[model samples]
Target: MFDFAIVGGGIVGLSTGMAIYNRFPNAKVVVIEKEETVAEHQTGHNSGVIHSGIYYKPGSFKACFSRQGSQSMKEFCQKYDIDHEICGKVIVATKQEEIPLLENLYKRGLENRLDIQRIGSVELKEIEPHVKGLGAIRVPQAGIVNYRQVSEKFASIIEEHGGEIRLNTKVEKIHEESTGVTIEITRGTIKAGLVINCAGLHSDRVAYAAGYKTDMKILPFRGEYYKLKPEKRYLVKHLIYPVPNPKFPFLGVHFTRMISGEVDAGPNAVLSFKREGYRKTDFSAKDLAEALTYSGLWKMAGKFAKEGFDEYIRSFSMKQFTKSLQELILEIKEDDLIPAPAGVRAQAIRNDGNMVDDFHIIMGKRTIHVCNAPSPAATASIEIGKEIVNRIPKQMNLKESKESVQIIK
Candidate 1:
């Protein structure tokens, strides 16, 4: 029997496994992933923007972890010789009405202790020549990195410390007893003293299978993107974002200068028929049925009917999508764009129809389920892993192992 078993080999799971070895070198630990490799989903498909923790509310998990995670992530990258850049971003107020919202965001950034600055149109022009905005907030700490590379490094560290990474191993069910927990997988069964449910999109289902009754349901929202053509990429010097609508949970269409030197634009959030649906045609009947039957989905739909419809429209109409991009960078044109792979966000919604704005984690008898972790999740992944390790119950016997730990200091 292993001392610990972690489900889902995403960035969070791999980082948790690394953290566990840091604390307990000789402990028998295993990471189980359904896919053939780690970071195959959200972690791999993200825009690779290392968030500066400006958008989150102060004192929330997102705020705390992201603030600390940014530093830790950069340090980790530097130590490992990974390719990354601290390219700052600007949240622009393109319209006069968005100025107040922009100011509010600046105050929120200050509350989060971020070193951000408010700039007028002239200053914004100096930074991004082609971008047009009345005002903007320049977040100098924002950066970008390939999280899949970071997660792979985490996996290597776990293995170096004698931890097992079981790829292509799917957890079918989880059963908890007085002594330990039993996990039934595709290949066979495994017993562990504790289990961590970092299953991302399937976290809620995993929690329910483990007998935890949560009032929230995981709803998948797909964010589609378009990459700027090589010749037209010069228009975007740094990340450019719009002031998010307070009523909406998404960050709206934005421009990002990825670590690979290509600029990506326009990721409009829309309801996905499948949890992992990346393409418009991708569909799963069961996924659609579950979403349609959920009371929360209907309630949320009713509340944001107009915004939802607009997102759907933008998803289908390239011209509409280009217009949103034009709001930030007027030089952008339909001919400058090319379709890029999309990502599905596993957003959690309550029975009351409200989206979980912060990161949500719940504890079970012998399991810890990470129910909601989306954007900035990759940015805050290392710190998040430490947070999970810190939350492990003392009864689980967290004493340090006798073997010497090999984790890089």
Candidate 2:
């Protein structure tokens, strides 16, 4: 029996596998991914932003882990000779009414002990030449990195430490035995002393398979993006995010300069017909039926009906998407925006239609289920992995569970 079996080969899973190895050198660990390669879903499609942890509540997991993970992630990259940049990002306030919200965000940043500063329009113009904002909060710590490359490195390190990584392995069922759990995958069955379900989009389903009473469902929200035409790439210098809607979970449409130097704009959030749906036409009957029959989905729809409708409009209409971008950059026209690949966020929504704002991790008898880990998860992956490893019982540890966190920095 493997000491630990980790489902999902995304950044979180690979990170967990590496953390387990670092914590328990003699323990046999295995990572199973349904995809042909690691990080094929959420981690692969990551926006490549190293979140600054400024938006999360102070002392929250999102804030603390991101703060730590951002540093640790950069260290791992540097050690492995990966490409990364610490260029800053700005949250611009285009309207006077957004100033208060921006100020609140700045306060939250200070509470989280971030190196945040409020910049006036003059400073904002100095940073992003074409951007227009009355005021802004410049988060100097925020940067960008290719999370997919990081995930691959994590996989390599796990294997180097005697861990096995199984690819094209689809976990169909998980049965908890008295001593351990028997996981039934596409290839065969495997026994594991402990199972870590870091299944990004399919986490709830995987947990339910293990008989965990999950009161939530994973609702996939597709964030459609438009890449700036080559000639229009000059419109955005770095990342220019608009003041997000306080009521919503998604960061509103904005411009982001990727690590490859491609400028992308306007990833309007809309419901996906399938869990892994990347295209608007991609639909799954099972996924659609589950979403349609869910009371939580309806409740969420009812609450954000107007905003949801607007997102749908932007999803199909380039003009509507360009309009959202124009709120920050006036020179952006529909012609300058080209269709880019979309990413689906596995946002966990409670039965009451309330979205899970915090990280939802459930520890069962012999398994740990990561039910919900939304945005910034890539940025916080290393810290998240350490936390998961730390949660294991002392008796189960190969050495000592109380080992101090080894910082790569």
Candidate 3:
């Protein structure tokens, strides 16, 4: 029997495993991933912007964790000799009417204690010459990195510390007992004294298997992106985002200069028929049936019918998608956008058509389930792992925090 069993091989799971193994070196820890590699889901595919906690409400988990996570992620990268850049981002206001919203965002940035500066059109032009905007907020703390590399580093640390990472292991059921928990996988059964569910895309289903009733349902929203051709990449110097519509869940289509020296735009959020569905038409019968039958989906459809329709239109029409990009930068033509990979956000929608804004975690006597972790999750993975480790009881302390499982140098 292992001391800890973690489900999911994404950044969150890997970081959580690292944190746990750091605290308990002697404990037999195992991380199980349904896929052959780690971060094959949302963690692997995202805008890859290390968020500065500017958009989140102050005092919320998103705000606290993201702020700390950014620092931790940067520190971890430096220690591990990983590739990253602390290139700042700007939130722009292209229209005159968008000025106040830009100001509000700057004020929110201040409230969040971010190193931010409000710049006029002149400074904005200096930062991004080709981009047109009336005003902008320069978030100096924002940065970029390849989270997949970070996940791999965490996996290596876990293995070096004597933890097992079992890939192609899908847990079908979880049974909890007075002593611990029993996980039934496709290969066989594994019993653990404690189980932490960090299953990203299938977290809610895993929680259900563990017998926790959540009012929120996991709604998959595919954020489709388009990469700017190498020649057109110079159009965006830094990440350029718009003021998010508080009524909706996603931050509007934006530009991100990735660590790999490529610029990608968009990631318009739309409902996905399958949990891990990335393609426009890829659908699972059960995943589709669950979403269509969910009352929350219907409620959301009734409320945001216009936005929903627009998203669906963009999903199937390249012309419409290109038009949306034109709002941020007019230079992007239909042909400039080649096929880009997609990430499905496991958004937790409530019964009242509300999208969960904060990170949601549930605790049992011997289990903890991460139900929702959306944007900035990759940036916030380290701090989220630390926070989760703090919540675990003292008896589970199989290793000391100060113990170097491996040489840091």
Candidate 4:
């Protein structure tokens, strides 16, 4: 039996696998991915921003991990000769009313001990030539890197360390026994001393399959993006963001200069009909039924009815989307944008209608389920991997090896 079997081959799972090998080099570790390759889901679809941890609550997993992960990720890239950039970003307060919120965010960034600067309009304009705002928070630590590349590197390191990565292997069921956990996959069953569920979009379902009861459900929210036309890309020098709506969980439509030099804008969050739905036309009957039937969704809808409606409007109307983006940069016109590939975020919502704002993990007998990890997850994958490895139950018989591999910086 393998010492550990990790489900989901996204960045988090791959990082966890790397962490396992780092902690116990002699232990047998297997990473199982349903897709043909690793990082095909959220990690592959990510915007590639190495978050600065400014927006997260202080002392939360999102805050701590992202703060530490940003530096560690940079070091990892440097060590592995991977391509990454520490290009700064600005959170602009377009309206006078948002200045308070901007100030609050600046304070939070300070509390998180980030290297952030509160700049006035002149400085904001100097940093981003076209962005219009009363004030902005310049976050120098925020950067961009292709997360798929990082995840692929993690997979390679795991393999080099003698861990196995099974691709095109979908996990159908998980049964835990006194001796080990029997995981039934598309091909066959495998026994493992422990299992780690990092199934991004289907995490809750995976936990449920293991007979673990949970009050929260994973709701898929599709974030559609529009890439700037090559000629119009000059408007955004770096990452430019508007003050996010305090009521909504998503960071509002923003402009991002990717590592590839292409600028993307306006990823408005809308409820998806399918878990993996990327386009407006894509629909799944079961996915829709589950979401529509969920009382938690209805409660959440009632709480933020107007904001939710606005998201749907922006999702369908290009003009509305452009208007939202215009709040950050007035030079961006509707003609300067082309629809880009969208990503679906797996946001966990509780029965009481509160979204799980922090990174959430649940430890069960012989299993550790990552119930909620989104946004900064790609940014904090390494630190999160270390955290998960640290959470491994002490009762599990780990190999006695004095020479532990150190993956962390």
The per-model lDDT (C-alpha) reads 0.91, 0.89, 0.87, 0.92
- Which stretches of model 3 miss by more than 4 angstroms? 395-399, 402-409
Superior by lDDT: candidate 1 or candidate 3: 1
lDDT tens digits, residue span 280-392, model 2:
99999999999999999999999999899999998888888888899999998888878898899999999999999989899998999999998889999988998898898
Worst 10 residues of 2 by lDDT: 400-409
TM-score (all chains, Cα) for each model:
0.98, 0.97, 0.96, 0.98
Please write out the lDDT profile of model 4 over residues 1-409, one tens digit for every residue: 8999999999999999998888888889999999999999888999999999998899999999999999989999989988999899999999999999999999999999998999999999899988899999999989999999999999999999899999999889999888789999999998999999999999998999899979999999999999999989888888998888887888999988898999889699999999988888889999899998999999999999999999999988999999998888887888999989999999999998889999999998999999999789999999999899999998887864555546655
Q: RMSD of each candidate? A: 1.5, 1.4, 1.8, 1.1
State the displacement of the C-alpha of residue 113, model 3, in Å, after optimal TM-score superposition.
Answer: 0.3
Error of 2 at 6 (Å): 0.2
Q: In model 2, what are the clashing residue pairs, if there are any?
A: none
| Ranking of models by TM-score | 4, 1, 2, 3
Q: Cα RMSD (Å) between model 1 and the true structure?
A: 1.5
What is the descending lDDT order? 4, 1, 2, 3
Give the C-alpha miss distance for residue 170 in model 1, angstroms.
1.1
lDDT of 2 at 135: 97
Predicted candidate 1 versus true structure: per-residue lDDT over 320-359, tens digit per residue? 9999999988888899999999999999999989999888
